[model samples]
Target: MPLAGGAVALVVTLTLWLSNMSRVPYEDALPTVGAVLALVGLAVLALRLVAGGWARAGLMSGVAAVYILYLPVAVFAVSPSAWMRGGLLLMGGVAAVLAARRIPREAPGVLAVNRKINLILVPIVIGIAGVVLLRQIDLERHRPAPDQAFAAFDGEASATSPDVWHLIFDRYGNNATLGGAYGYDNSAFLSALRKRGFAVNEEAFSNYQRTGHSVASTLNASYLDRLSSSAQAADWVPIYRSLTSSQALRFFERQGYETVFAGSWWNPTRRSGLADRNINYRAVPELGRLVLGQSAIGFALAQTGLAYGDGRGDQCRRATYKFEQLRELADEGSRKYVFAHFLVPHPPFVLNADGSCRSLAKATASSRRDNYVAQIEYANREALRLIDAILAGPRPAVIVLHSDEGPWPEPFVGDERFLGRDPVAVDWAGLNARQLAEKMGILMAIRHVDGAPAPAPASPINVYPQIINAYFSGKGVEPAPRHYVFESDAALYRFKDVTRELN
Candidate 1:
């Protein structure tokens, strides 16, 4: 019984680990599997102590049968509905229990039968896990490097350099998109930015519809079309490498600028080894936190209102802390390149406009539009405050305020829920203009100490190059031409020149 239970736990762990290896670490699965095995073992032992030999053996067999069937049942189920999957699992469990009852309680060979079952299943499960681990190792070895797509800037540094602040507000929409879609006028935020000398790009759009691709493209100063052919969208290693070890950071490092990173709870931008300094609230490893949040126990606790399994309040506190840290950094007397990624105006909307924690139920139960707009109002006010402090700092600075993507549309309020859906199964043909706009429209503005406002209708990929040309002209690098490209979130590697389509 113990061996069978252990085998079940092993198989489930390996399956989940293999599926999410790109985003989750191998170590995170170990604890979850251990807990499952311990619980099942305890339950089997308790049954053995109280029940007759025949009944105990039958229950053990039934459990083993259910676990064995779970893999195929879960794999073959095509529906996204959780209830459907649960119903299928329950039916399988019922069938297994009934079949176990046919075995005699007094059978002389019952022990032998159970032993043979465990002997057969244990090796198979272990072998499967070993194979999966080997394949994952190979995938890690062959992952692409960021330097392949971007060359190091070979330009001489200017004698005088301004502090550069690149602040990303995840999923923030532009004024027109906000007004048209949510009827929320964003003029106050834009006017505030302009008052602080920011040239708000009213027509700016993200180069990619997702954060990983968008940030990767902008930071590398290149479109991902070339790399997409050779890269796998399912594997996030290449994308993360692009964000952390990009040519952009190396370029700034070469120019005698100290690199400071302020990251959110998201793994990719949470912290970087390349940064000279890091600011983050959560000390827990991101993969571990993610694993715990998605575990069965965590789900149960969340549903029962016993815990904030999603950690929305923690994220809110982290956002507040990050903003405060950025404010402190503005006073430092060094030429620094600050990259702060804030999860604001993004869901698990827990912050009111005044920065106080809102009830998690209110945040979740409210219409997606209402929660998003309120968060946006909060983000806008906080952002202006941060910008004002940075502008009043010791040195002249260049601040680029932007979003990796725009507010998600109906049926997709948060990126987590949106990305969880199978991309291939989505109906791309039915995607309308508003949906596309929601995915593409983003916020972008630049405040340079001594430069004209950036041209309207800017692409994020070109923003840094223009900055380089204006401030570090010795590099002699031409600015990337402004062009709009749209790629389906389903086919992440595919790119379409949608400049004309949107126009």
Candidate 2:
């Protein structure tokens, strides 16, 4: 019984841990429930082990039921670590042993077989019904209705434009490094946008930290408080669904832009389905392997989740595929808003064109600097490619290229230095600016591309508003104040000095 209980407990703990790693809430509760249930299950398992009776089959059946339920759920929450998978397999062994022990006490072999069948069938039916309902609800909310054409991105504004390119090179740091390290000034990239008459907003800072938060906020134009509150809700599914159904799509579609989404590897179900057209890195064989591998592993372990090789070595190459993807969209003669989200500078640092990370990862701080510089350079080059394609085509286009948020600080990139931790309440009892900045305003850049960059001290919150105003809403159609400069909480950052450069 103890063994059976332990197995159950182990399964629950793995689920909880995986959920935590995946940033899912309820990490604490699941384990508590599992622990209690495990104890109960364990007692039954133990009795059969000792009595050498029909209890063995019952134990095996229960263990199987627990895993069949737990493993799939874990996959949705987090990628299964090697440990979680092994733990599940181990439970199967425990069940088999308990079942074998029951063979001896059976009054009739037929009756024992029938009981075993019933135990398995009951749980299986319940599980199937639950999964079906959950999936149905998920689809109803997120999936587009058959009558709707993927949020209609090609309305009026898309009518006479050349080609619109929204090149979002994920976290590609700025100009100086691009020029010195990549041996090419990112000016080449900027020059291309300028030639296309894009009045770039050179000083654009992303409103939020991290991709999920940043991207979610960008599309929905909602502040972190709302997003965080949503995240903390009873279910995250609604949050994901809400963002999917944002009014931004309808707005963009009304602007006459045919939006197409392209990315190396991400669950397109979230972003792609919302766009008019979605292309994945899976279209190319080499990139397809990485996409499929991640998907397969994710499917197997129920974990789905990027790599930008660190440094200057192959940053250009890293951006190449995305640039090409954007160019293809531009060539389609559709006034398009192509979201080319490149997964660079993320981690595991393996996808380098120059294969530099092999030697660089072992290097010290200075070497790490060189590696990051290399990545920045590559990012710049890719930016240039997309910009050139747009400039070459005839069109009155506005290019807005910016980071999702700030990079990590120090020996690592985007560390606490960039993202100040949420303050402990007592710490703020008497703290002021110095303390606040230490915990909040990590220097983040919102550098823009064409137009006269908006006065600094801009809010990442208003990025969407600014873009819409610049591209679609026209000058007089001022967005709400919250859109321009919202705070992490629902508070607002007052407009201050416009001349200050991001420190």
Candidate 3:
């Protein structure tokens, strides 16, 4: 029985760990592993107390088998509801227990068959785990390095090198996009920004459609295609590294300024070890947390009311925590380059326009368009408050309010289930014109403390370069070319020049 429990624990832990090894650290899997093992151990002990001999042994083995296979069944099975999957597993377990009670205790043939099955199963599980571990290790070893060669501005830092604040609001659409799609007029938000001396770009579009590519290009001041080859397109590790440890942060660090980051719960922007200071609200390790959220055990816990709340509740907590931290930064006296990325107006919409938590039931019941508008309205209110606080601070700051990428459109809302599909096969011609435009259209506005010589560019790629040129060195940075690039959901690293397609 002990051996059976150990085997089940090992197989389940290894499967969960290896599946998420690329995104999360090994240590993060320890808690979930321990919890799973403990649950299985408790179940075995309970069955032993109620039944003796072959009945106990059979029931223990049955529970172990169900636990081990539960994740695959829940994830790959036709049913999407976690509750439905859990109920199915529970029924299977009960059936196994009942059947085990009928087996004869003194049967030599039964004992021999059970012994042989255990021996075979243990070795097979171990071999599968070993293979997965080795493959993950190979993928980690071959991860690509980010491009570090940026045009350095060798100018002295004067009292006029304004404290820069790069504020990114995830999936925020421009006024026109908001109005056209969701019937929400965002001009009030734009007017508020304009009132604060920000040069709002009404016709601005993101250089890339995805967050990883858009942020990577913006911070590096170059496109991902130019920086790295297509070989690293399968994963997001390279792009994540670029966002955290890019030339942009390094540039500010060299200019006698402290780089403080208020990152979101998302892996790419969560916490930057490269920055002088990192602030995030998620207590658990990121990769492990994300992986656990998708697991069968995690689903069971959530369904049984053991969890704090659903994904919507967690999103609200993160968004609120990040925003509060941004508000407090107004009191800091140091010349700091603060980068606060807020995941708002995104999916799992949790907020209403009035700052009250939207009921999870209501949010889920609402249409995607309704949920988006509610969050966007809430974000607008919060953004204005943060902007006011920053502008009222003791020191002058250059604030760039932008979005990593615009809101996803119809038939392609924010779900990533389509990642495995071939990008080349997707019919780009069938994409809706308004939806495509909205996806490409992002919120971009910049406020220079002291008036700048040049206007802010439409593309995020030129944002950092323009800042360096305007304040640090009086030299001119060339404008980004008037072209849009689109990459498919499956192949994020592979680029398609969709400039003419959009036009």
Candidate 4:
């Protein structure tokens, strides 16, 4: 009976995990599943040791009855959400399950016969359910190896190295896109970068639309086509998995640099296994919240606003914390390679130019534009302040001020659902040339040590290769052609090269 309960538990939890595989990896929930199984196994073993013959069978039957009634009822009852509410329903279910055992003796012959049949039927029902749920998982499609993805970027470690900082300002558009698409002039910011010994790529774009794929391509020193082709088409698990570790981090580690990762509230970036130190703030990990939302009790609790970890205020605070932390780390005198992905000026329009928080009044294009401008205005001041500090440090540094991807096009600027919506679900053909550039054009600025040549036609994809050749002297590799691939949101893996159309 306990063994039957174990199978039911596995089926329930794994079904939830598989349903949300886009955010949570399959291996993460395995530990919890394993613990449940272990506990059930121990309970059966102890019962066998303590009880003999019919006594053991009766005890096991009771244990099975309680578990059989408990888990599903506890998880799925009383649709509304709260910890107190879910807990009460769970206790009520247990009381009823225990009470039902006694009332069966008082009932008629039909009730006794039905009870016996149910005892036999429950295990078979659970077995069939487990088989049906297991079919959802596809084990053949695995993630690509980082080493193979970064083959062209192979290099031997150099004895002398400068502090490298790859600062990704989320959704910070290039000057061209800012002026042409958003009706905002960003020449002042670009001019400031130029004055600080930085080369701002006048024309730069990301091959992918999403942040996960863009960062993966840049750090792994290959495009998503190279990376995504290795993985199963339309499977986003590989893209998110690349965030935790990358060949870029490994290369710096090999060169005896202490790796530091400061990420946004996104789950994959919150902590990295390969980094020496992680600058994760008080923001809750998204993976935990995602898995919880899949469960019955958790789903009820979520409706009361307890399940969501996101608030516009958190977006403001976390970005501030990251900026402060990055500035502090710059002067720490360690040979550090910091990759800080800050989610600011991206959405929700929560920040003002003077560092004060503001809420959006309405979902209008004008209102969104005003709010977005204010947020980016704040980001600019912060970026300049950070750049000054990094430049003023005792040791020379190489700072790459890049954006993962450009902002949403004019069509989504006023939509509140923009952030939560699956980005690739849109009609790829709907985006105009200007809108396409607005979404894909990014800010790529590099400040190299002692005049390391800037990448020609310096797109984000070309940054690492140029850095390797100039700083690490890895190989004589030509700059990757300025080819861009646009994939339909509906068919994620299908690539359509639109370099000519954009150019």
Candidate 5:
């Protein structure tokens, strides 16, 4: 009986451990394939124990206790969801009582029996095997690989245009915002790109307000409407074992370019576990580490905002990581399409090496300006460093320093004409998830160019198609409509006919 109970415990442990190791979030109420199989093994153990004079009630009760009380607290923390919490507590209590019933009442006999239960070797062996097997499979099959499609395209266009480097400066808005709010002339940025002989898109908007949605759309050259419709929690894992995976490295695969995803951000990569193949995460090892540290701060900041899990940390980290990855991509000497996403000129404004506030509780307009200037200065420095790195590469490259969205707090922007007044603050009780995200500064995209074309009005959604049409179709297809770029408000949506205010 004890042996059988040990086996059930082993199965439960295996399921939890394996699922967590896979980094798959528990949603949809369906256990992963491995977890399901492990449960079956536990059921078999339960049957065996029941046959050998095990108290069914006690064994079941123990199972209930572990699942209800222990599992919920370990993951979700203590909450006032009493009905759910009560259910778990009940199961745990029952399991404890049932477990007690299975042991001999006599203390000595119970001690002897407990000793034997602990000595069971088979279940322990099985548990070890489960951990090793799950981890090994993840290591072997899911790493990043060269994108064949990207490679094919690279071969086809090795000499047409310089190597394309799409550098995302997280959420700096367009020229309008930069010029109006900061009072800095964008002519320097524009002039720099023109000097490098590239056409820049001054009017660009992100199809989605959030970085992951926009970045994914840009990388894939597809629309967010298509991808978001199917993105599930499991899809968020680092590995792409599931069928719904659609983060953009695959597009590069078709083009035959060696694609690398290095960043400090957490994205679908956390779930896809495909870092081994076409989406390497450790591209800029040191920068990746620093970005990760920044992400920790980003996460804490989120707790105070509306979008509970906006993936900013993931996006920020990814941006920094991608910058680091350039060195490796250059070293590989493979025709490459590198997407370097950097989260700068964005906030917490807390990541400064010198550590100072960009704005404070009583910040005046000048103080706000000072804060943003510091951030822009930092972003510009990083941007220059990245461009130098790309130019220093053996091959000629087309580097694009772009932003996903603009700054937040409409008042700091001071352009009542362009940005609307800040959204009304909700009472504490009225606060919902979306409000939090807005406060934290989502939905801003800025573009500062160095080697790319002069700025045009654009969105991230247009980036891929623009690149593909330029490089792949060779004038076969017309450019996507400028207005087709995705934009967002309280509700995230595509900008079918957005107000083109930069004029």
Candidate 6:
């Protein structure tokens, strides 16, 4: 009974944090759990001074116990009907209150058993926390030096610098995958790019299935063979570390060019310590969004205007801000290398086709393919404008535009009914070739100055190397072997190359 509140709180927080280890940071739950446990412990202590031990215990544990009881019913929010979810909330709250009331009157033997359970729980939670902390402590300690493939040239440049803009169209699918899986043709968009002097790849696919692996591979110009194939829970810490301080960025920084990074809501693409200017919008924290914000209580908070993810308003703002920055920076005539990651044409489908933000109500009810195509249309239209503005600028220009990975399968990010469920729950191993392609496909194109042919990579691993070979004077690295690998969400580091299957 003495440890019940704090024990349950720690265990619950630990569960949420562990299941989302790849997405959530190691410290995400520590402070919240500590503050909550302390608050409840102090309340119990104060109440015990004036009241009976049983009364104090029940009062102090009420909120913590409510959340525990609420977990089972949290799945109720998945139903499309709002009334069903609201009813579950009301009934769950009532049940929690009644349980608290009954706790004070429990028999001695029952209270003793409850205390025993808590005794076991508290130690187990602490041990788990201790084991995970050591690995995460040195996540950012690695500062990757330039690869020997890229080491030949001292990073020196700046003759009108031919300002470079690398843009990421998150979840933008390639032509075949868009048409084959979703029945959405993108030929006109490719034709549009051709007119803008871009050599578009109709069959481009990501080298990895997930964003972290794909991005780290692309930015570093190599595969994640360094990561163990049987990587465990804490493995993502280093992936994130490698992502922010990539070998590619180091090479850019050496060229005497200013590095500008614009980020979005997703964690891997959220920030970069190496960039001279990191552009990001005010959005809900990644931990809160991926963990608590997807909960039933988070749904309630959003309904009552207490939550921050309003129609992905911050994503719309961030993406719009990136386009605006591109317009100004392209025209500013400065020597620069800009990496702008736009999380759009992606999920939640909140950004409308006509450059407007859709209401959360409509976004929740949207058909998956229709809204995805809508966002792609919006990206196509705006990108043309940005390209035109850049081409007219005083300095020579280069644009490397591509998607990190393709559209997520509908089961992972459908309407509100599916949004709260974990992507790991989907059977990635069971996916057919087309479905795999749907997830692996991407939009890729490159442009260089003077109407010269851009040397596009077979996959993302060769992207930076090709860029270096075309522009730099020294002997550049050979393109790394191209292979598209997918791993189960359960084992993020384990690899199974599906290159032939996708072909």
Candidate that would win on TM-score: 3
Tell how far residue 210 is off in model 5, in angstroms.
2.8
Poorest 10 consecutive residues of model 3 by lDDT? 416-425
What value of lDDT does candidate 4 attain over all alpha carbons? 0.66
lDDT of 4 by residue, 177-267 (tens): 7787668998898888888788778788876666877787778777666655666665666666666778788888888889999986676
Worst 10 contiguous positions by lDDT, candidate 4: 50-59
Q: For residues 1-503, what per-residue lDDT tens digits would candidate 5 score against the true structure? A: 33434344444444444544433332211233334345445654655464343334234433432443245443235645646554655565566556655656454665466556446645574767667576646543433222311221222343454456666665565565566656755567556555545456654555444455445545544443442333332232322222113334454555566655443333333323333234444332222222222232223333443232323333334444555556556645556656554546655342332223333332233455555556576665556556666666676655555665556534333421111132233232222333222322222222222334344425565554555555555342323533232333222333332323221
Poorly placed runs, candidate 2 (over 4 Å): 1-121, 124-163, 174-203, 222-243, 264-270, 282-321, 353-367, 394-396, 411-503
- Candidate 4 or 6, higher TM-score? 4
Q: Against the hidden reference, what TM-scores do the models get?
A: 0.74, 0.53, 0.77, 0.75, 0.51, 0.73
* lDDT of the candidates, in the order given: 0.69, 0.43, 0.69, 0.66, 0.44, 0.67
Residues 31-55, candidate 2: write the lDDT tens digits.
Answer: 4444546555655665556545544
Candidate 1 vs. true structure, TM-score? 0.74
Give the lDDT ranking, best first.
1, 3, 6, 4, 5, 2
Q: Which scores higher on TM-score, 1 or 3?
A: 3
Where does candidate 5 stray beyond 4 Å? 1-162, 182-191, 224-248, 269-325, 353-372, 410-457, 473-476, 482-503
Cα lDDT for residue 502, model 2? 30
Alpha-carbon deviation at 118 in model 3, angstroms: 9.6
Tens digit of per-residue lDDT, candidate 1, span 169-210: 988998878998888988888888887778888777787667
Q: Pick the candidate with the highest lDDT.
A: 1
Across residues 1-503, which tens digit of lDDT does each residue of candidate 6 receive? 56666666566666666666555654444555566577668866765664367544634464445454345346454666667766766776676666655554455754665666666766887886765564344442331222422233333454534667788887888888788767888898888788777887767788887677788788877777665532353356556655767776787788877888887766666777688888876644455454445445566765665535343665566677778877887777567778877767766566788888766667667776777787888898888888888888877877888998887776665343222232445556567787788888888898877656565557777677666656764356665455555456556666777778877
- Candidate 4 residue 239 Cα shift, in angstroms, is 2.3
